[model samples]
Target: MNRFRYSSHNLYSLLSQPKSPLHPPTLPSQTLVSLDPSSIDFSNSNQFHTNSSCSSTIPSVSSTGSCPDSALASPFSIKFRSLHLYRGGYIDKGLLVNLYLVKHHCYGTSSSVNQCGFRNVGVNELRYFASHKQVRDILGMIRRKDNDLESKVRSMNVSLNLKMCSRFFEELNNQKRDALAVCDWIRYAHPSCRNDVHSMVIDNLGRLGNYDAMARVLSEFAKKKVRLVPLAFEFVSLSPLKEATVMKVVDVLKAVEEPTRGSGLCSLIKMFSAVGSFDMAELVMQLSERKATFYKIMVVEKCGKGDFEGAADLVEVMRKHGLKPEAKIYNYVLSTLCKHDKSAEAGALFEEMLASECAPDPITYEIFVCHSCKAGNFDLARKLLDRMNAQGIEPRVSMHGVILKGYFNLKRFEEAYEYVMACDRYICFPAICSTLARLYVKADNVIVAHNLLLELIDRGLRPDQSVYTNVFRRLIDTGRTALAEDLRSRLSSIGSKSTMGAG
Candidate 1:
């Protein structure tokens, strides 16, 4: 027996009828909640009722008297269904569609769409109702070795565009084999979009650190005479591939136009320099006109390895090349020197940077301020903040925290309290306030902490949860139940407002 009481055609046809004037349209049941109309796959109608236990018939409207209140409360159950019609039409069309997709497409229940008279419905119809999140989830299933789902999609012969493929690639989470398989699927489904897919796949593989596979794919692209873009090599510079493998990729990329080739080779120079292959870096540097860019990359790598002397040498080399070294290069070396307690060296470099007319940017000032705060030189840190203000550079809220914490660290409670009070609204970030609240509590100044929490509330800022809990607890512990209760109420209000704003 055909267990389903109604055919797909019968169900959709009956729902399309105009609602009779005597019977009003009622909201759908709670089961319709969380249903995404766009994700419903209509490819298989027989799978709709494959669950044998679901063979029971729908009850008529007269039996229930009216739509149940449970259905009325669902926010998503807005679609209306006529109660006086056949039981098949009594439920919202969206509900029926969602049930079909969940069973057949997602859960992999086996049945024949042809048997259900839905053979004419193609994957395109299913895709019309599918969301991007659903597509990503399908790709994610393929990544987790769900061969059945993969086979199902293959049978459907679905085609995705460049944007869709790029999104699906991100959801692969660096699964190299899955990326290739999905790319192959795309190539089969849409041959014209293969070139775009190639760029995405190569870039993804590079990020996955699978350059041997990337090189093979690059060679294929070369054979196809597909034009390469600079973005294709974006992540290759960070990959830890063998020198030979890197060279193999570089050789295959020779077919790329000169402009792209130059940019691509510069990325390789960064890779070589980062891996301590300076000789190879220099050799590759000779192949590109962006020698200054190559110098910057090498300087950063040298600084990362704590070779400040080598980085400075690179700066001198750039000068010799008639390329004025930027503040970025100086800041990189300056940050490293300060981190390593070579403050005197950093100060000299700062002066030299000034002499070289590399007008110190905000980062340049921040570096010195951070270093001074760390070294217990609050006076110099304050002077830097003043200089930043004089130059109209807004001091970063983080710098305020650094200076405030420096005072707290040295047990200068009076100074820390005064500093927090003196700061304007822009400087009083919630994190800084939280840090000060914590420090004050630790110093047995619960009253100040309590007051700071109130002020934060007045400024419409929610304190960190831990700080909120700590202050609220301290209030109760000090026999101030009324204040604690009031604080709890205010925090709850803030949370409610935040939730509403998000909604």
Candidate 2:
């Protein structure tokens, strides 16, 4: 009998039953003390926008262009007036809506729409609720009843549905609107006890990478004298943190007094590394030595900022501390050096990568190949390319395009055929295909560029307008305007204008 032991109590794991359909799994139970609505305040909320006109907040002056007599009106062409304006003026579209307006005026249906039956409603109904301006207006009307315009809205009070709260989060996060800005407009303006919206606001603040903002939100959660503020501490790992601010956080964290994780301490080291504050990083590193993440980030950031000397110093520090730098770590350093036009330094780093236990990735070898060709180090580039192939890391066509150009530039016409042969499809990316097309244009081989572009499109690689423009320009310049015109039609079908300056 097979003797492998497995826990049997949780049969639901085998069934893969969903935990929650309506919401994501809960975070650590938020212990935030509820503030009275009167205590909730933001002075910035009333600051009128300087760029806005008192008369109208509609961003653009209306287009006077009318449809020609011969043209039919577009089904999708809806008027773009500033929403909820009597004529054209910015006023509070408070968050309450009359149930009657939503029931009757929304769809010309007279039926009363009361409580949303399900918290997470049907998708078809959601799509309508999301797109239809009437629901948006209703939610907008539900904001602060204190606004003079919304005084009437207070008479017919309505709280936002959970679904609508989720929608607000969606829009704000998309715009990357400041968390406090969203709070001032929605939560503070129209207070709700919904944990979902509050948690979402805090989470979004965390993601946007402001340590102070995170700390402010978490302070309301509870001052802990034992465990670390897990959520508040995440943003500290993000680089470019001011030293003065970080020190303040460090002091506050000490006061809140938690058993600190080594990883958390390491994040401070990383922030120092990002800003090239090596002394600060070293101070933290002296407290602990196994932080591989801290070392890796320092090398990449130093190289990116063109402090090759600092990056080299970090590598030496890594070795001195017995921390083994990984392959991808070396890849990042190599990419940064090559980007900054330090090919010789990049080549030197490549040698170190090879000598060390870290295997050079395809990206490392390819970058060396591209710049080596540009620098006229043809032999070195070719040797590196052969080593890259030997490693059995699949050659990207983007990388190969560099070598192909090198061959063309060297007048190695005989070798060109061998380079253009089919490569492994299992690992090929659409980016390489785009690169190949662009390379053909540079070589004045318009026919190949045109055919390859069509092939890419046929294989479900959708090029953006910029890609279309690049190829179209090349084709037009090369007197392949007929072919360019054909591609233009395809581009136009996707709503990209190909004739703006194709000449």
Candidate 3:
């Protein structure tokens, strides 16, 4: 008795029985606009719209519609029609046996009489194996027969057939289950598979949150000249692991030969600083041995995180690597030191950056001025500002705002006002406007504050609620409730929503 059995079921019954009474085809409610043949030029067919709304113009017959006779007229179509006919049980028994032999031999299965007969029996009865489950079982039996017959065949030709059949089952199994697994099999099984398994692995690994595994795979791929650094960076950036682990992975990738280029390293650096891993970030900088631009950014970032020692170490490393420190890096270091009350060192670094060939830009001078003012060294800050002008680097509005803020900190409103006027003449930046408004509110000059707010509005710049809210709170704190209430109402009338409770 044959181990494989096929059940008898018509193709139409197999395709359509699961659904309810089939609805008759109806014309679309939209009128079909007939194009004038003269206007329908096919020459520029490539210009057709490919968007979803236009895709329905392409016609296709329903799968349940009768197969067209015209499709079965050609030789290739006849072969396809023959397969469909075999699927529909229309072939003679002798022809069925011959076709089975041909299919088995072509696909690298055994050509023995027993195998051919088994195939014949299976093919003839395939209609009876109607359900997908039943078809799967029948294919399994065929696979077993192929595997068993492999040992009996003596020729190289038979071995080739066995290999083909094995591959066929592998493909079938892959199709039946996980696409990723199938992709992996194809990617590693044949050099000609052309599927990028690295991408598939990275995608699945990221989705699964397997960072360690992803890191390992990416490292291996990178060694093989596969560019997985971008994905690796994303994995490390989003992984819920400790910032230290993220930094470690970044360092490892950076050390890897010719790391995948573009944005990967930059994003890693940002992620490190975002998570407060300045120390580890410094290590990454040292390991990468990157250009001045990278080190300058790292130093500035470390300073922002208040890691002064880390910033200092980065400077040392820059000098050790024979890279001249730029004005931006020095400014960041100086600002950080000044904020921490290391005014002497801050001033020294500022002077050193200025003396170097990489002359201090306006931003660098601004940092020095702000630091000096913060340290109650107003004379020094004024001298630096004069020197900056002499060097032909005009102060930006931010520089004026910082000096005004410094004056306000020292209770020198007259000096702050003078700097505000100077800022207006040179560059009228939003920061300058906000600072002046804030100062006006401090001095109870509500009219000037309101005018500055209107100026900001006229310039098409939307001031954050905090800007007005801080001023209102300051006014209220100073026992100027009436003015504060009036300003609040005016702000609301202009669509500035406040988060503060009414007094």
Candidate 4:
């Protein structure tokens, strides 16, 4: 899951000096040659040629026969075995996994047992690591518009598949134009999957609320007379709708023939309702047949705007239309009632939801717990937390944080500490621990806060940088220069980015 950031300086480091225990015993003809991936000019086909004197140290490969055609067999072939890649003073799992593949490819089904009996890193384990690295490298090349990108990929024997391209596209920063460039390359490389790739672009644009870029893409598709993909509309269904964006969508839909255009209009209606444009959405919905869906979305929007009565009235309207409201619709109303101090009404509605066969979800309980904490009713919040556990619904960390904040507000530090400790060990405690440390610092108990922060670090929990910075600044002001510097170094080692530079 780790996306490696590559640089020329550390692209490939020399690990030629063999280490005992980690490295296998030397063979008669085997000599290790580290391939510095960054230094190789992948545009040169000759770069893949094997040196006659050199032989793979990897077991099962005979020292004879022309070395496996080092040139990329196809766009997807990767020379995983030829490179010794290392970063940050440790062997990456990618190298180990590729080495496993090399041995397997050499051994084939001749034997499940490794002939050389090397320690198995498990077959195909960390395979994605190597593939991700190669994909990222290609993405980087594309970003720089490197003319050698195609040659490099083919020369390095790296495989570019649709999945890898999609992942790299998702990881691209929220720059739509940059994503568009990548999308074009993907479309050219994978003509068969053009719609799927375009869907990704539209999803990214909608997720970022970049309607301008989305409009351009839609316009280009219309110009090309490409049929609008149904999936694109699905992605944009929850996006915030604007007049200009909707117009562009309408223009594109005019070209796409029936059925799909009909589906697209439905999604457009949902998009409008999602953004609280209920009146406009209702007008659009007149062209569609999904009355129930539109009503549900409106109820949620009404609750969001704190119009509890309006949301409740919409629920009655749904029932009149023979559409049963879901737990989510009731939950929104409950949340609004609680927010408006209508706790009695919320309680009644909760009972009604249960009676109507609408099972309460995690959010239903979360709403009550949050209200209880805000009302300073710790007893009720604690009971609600227990009920959530009894119902097999795990309370999120934010809920615990909320209760802890309540205790800290009442200056009940002992109870807060005990409560956190009593919670399951599996529950993440960094945020809770950070809140405690910050409280100590706020009370002018700098030494206690500093000590607590150190203990949390030893427990492998990272405190927020704000608390660390505060303690560091306090230490300096108190003339404890060495202590202040040590804290700063510790912060740097933890890789926490601080707002202020070390002073």
Candidate 1 lDDT by residue in tens digits, 1-503:
11113333331222233432222213223211111122222111121122222223332111213322222111112221111112222345443444334331221111332222222233322222234665766766767767565565566644455676666667664554536755666665544456566666777776676766766666666656665543465455555664555565666556455444554576567656767877677766544344667788888899999888888778877887788999888989888988987665676676667767887787888887777776677767776777777877876655676777666555555566556656644444565666667656555556677777777777677776676677788888989899889888877676544311000
Q: State the TM-score for model 3.
A: 0.40
Best by TM-score: 1
For all predictions, the C-alpha RMSD in Å is 23.6, 22.1, 28.3, 22.6
lDDT at 465, model 2: 37
Off by over 4 Å in 1: 1-263, 291-293, 322-324, 425-434, 441-445, 455-470, 473-479, 485-503
Give a tens-digit lDDT track for model 3, residues 1-503: 12112223321122222322223223222311111112211112121222232211111112332222221111122432323322322334444343444442222112342222223332222211023443354345445544432222211121122233234344434433222323333343323212133444454555454556655665566566665423334445555764655556555456445444223455456656667765555556655546777677678778888877677777767887889987768778866776776644554554445445668788777776666565556666666677776887877755666666666555555555445545543334555666666555545554555556655555554344445666667668778788778766665564444222111
lDDT score of residue 24 within candidate 2 = 21
> What TM-score does candidate 2 reach?
0.44
Off by over 4 Å in 2: 1-248, 251-275, 285-290, 336-345, 405-415, 422-438, 441-503
How do these models rank on lDDT, best leading? 1, 4, 3, 2
Model 3 RMSD in Å is 28.3
- Candidate 1 similarity to native, TM-score: 0.51
Off by over 4 Å in 3: 1-262, 265-289, 297-310, 320-322, 422-425, 429-438, 447-503
Point out the higher-scoring one by TM-score: 2 or 4.
Answer: 2
TM-score of each: 0.51, 0.44, 0.40, 0.43
Q: Pick the candidate with the highest lDDT.
A: 1
Candidate 4 residue pairs that clash = 76-159, 77-157, 78-157
Q: Report the C-alpha lDDT of model 2 over 242-327, residue by residue, as the tens digit.
A: 45445655554333322333434555666566666777666655544456787776777677787776776677678777888877
